[model samples]
Target: MLVAAAVCPSPPLLVPEVAAGAAPELDRARAACFDAVAVLAAARPDRLLLVGTAPEAESGDYPAGSAGSFRGFGVALDVRLGGGEPGPRELPPSLTVGAWLLERTHWQAAPPTARALPDTLPPGDCLAAGRELAAGDERLALLVLGDGSACRSAKAPGAWDERAEPFDAAVAGALGTADGPALAALDPVLARQLHVAGRAGWQLLAGAAEGADLAGRLLYDEAPYGVGYLAATWS
Candidate 1:
């Protein structure tokens, strides 16, 4: 069953080395992520499933020690998913950010398992995958990573879009309350047009937490750098 979850944004800039001078701007979001992880640790789950968006069409499982690097972002810094020996496959940017969070928190409770789903995955499929993940007998926690709309402002990566604000607001509401149906109801076409990369991952989260009695707390929500970066915890 799902015991806890931490929702975070997937941006290479979360790494201090990658952000450099602009690193300070994301300090609050980083701190909130740490706090969310701390809550998950407190739950003492048996496993931690790291969920994120990927370029693939379906979920991709990454071993506990999979490695990820920020070299593509002009940084050579490397991160391993857990303390275990490194695996053969390296993580994508989304999972790389998830790995960085686990490393930052020095995750020591439950072992982490990585999984990523395609951005265009249907919500029903995401929910099904989530239900299957939650079916395991062992207590499970999740570290979900993906960014909201990238076009919150004219300076946004995807440029300004009138629909961005309302879309992000709804997402924030769903996450803040752990409202499964709301997340599951997100409009794929609108999300795509708005550049919301986190839709699939968040829908998966809704599926995993279905019927779970966890309460939610919104830790952080902002459109820093023109990307919607939200942090929340459910436990």
Candidate 2:
């Protein structure tokens, strides 16, 4: 199996032609959502799975009037292949992987800000969901998440330095999208953080200067945030 990951590096809030400024919070949320989808696709497994929990009301800084967030959600897509003469009963495999991933991974509440929530989404639950969706076929699995710190920073448990390269620039270059205006508008620190995450994403998929390839012949495209995007094939 091979994997490829890419980031969009912050898509335009408002159309480039529009004069209105982009919404920072909204952009961040959108980018995070898109990044999650990209991660799952990179895994290139038969089924797509998502495992996460909503914030508790007692949790500090919980948003008022917010419905409980998605603790976990998952979806499975059926793929079929046929020889030369396509049979009418045979279905196309690419009917809608992107849309399926989007529909399955979307979150209603704010993205997980603290590590507590994601940790609650145990690997067991993720695996179970994938199993059910894939009918017990678990040869490989894909995991995706938002939060820049999730990929970097040693503070979080299980945080590894596997892929630390910047993912933002590579995504931008691959998707043929730009964030010059957004970067100029953001605070220097935030801008730098975004860039760093982008680079890290690239490094994760592309590998370090002297490291082995984590993914092979992976295809990348532009997404929402300055996050990298990737699509990989796995067994």
**Tens-digit lDDT track of model 2 for 174-224:** 323222222122232432333332222222222211111233222343332
Tens-digit lDDT track for model 1 on 1-235? 9999999988989898999999999999999989988999999999998988888743488988899999999998999888778877789889999889888888888878899888989999999999988986779999999889999889998999989988998999989998889999999999999889899989999999998898889999999978899999999
Model 2, stretches more than 4 Å misplaced? 1-44, 56-137, 149-235
* Candidate 2 worst ten-residue window by lDDT: 90-99
> Lowest summed-lDDT stretch of 10 residues in model 1?
51-60
How badly does each model clash, as a count of residue pairs? 0, 27
TM-score of each: 0.97, 0.25
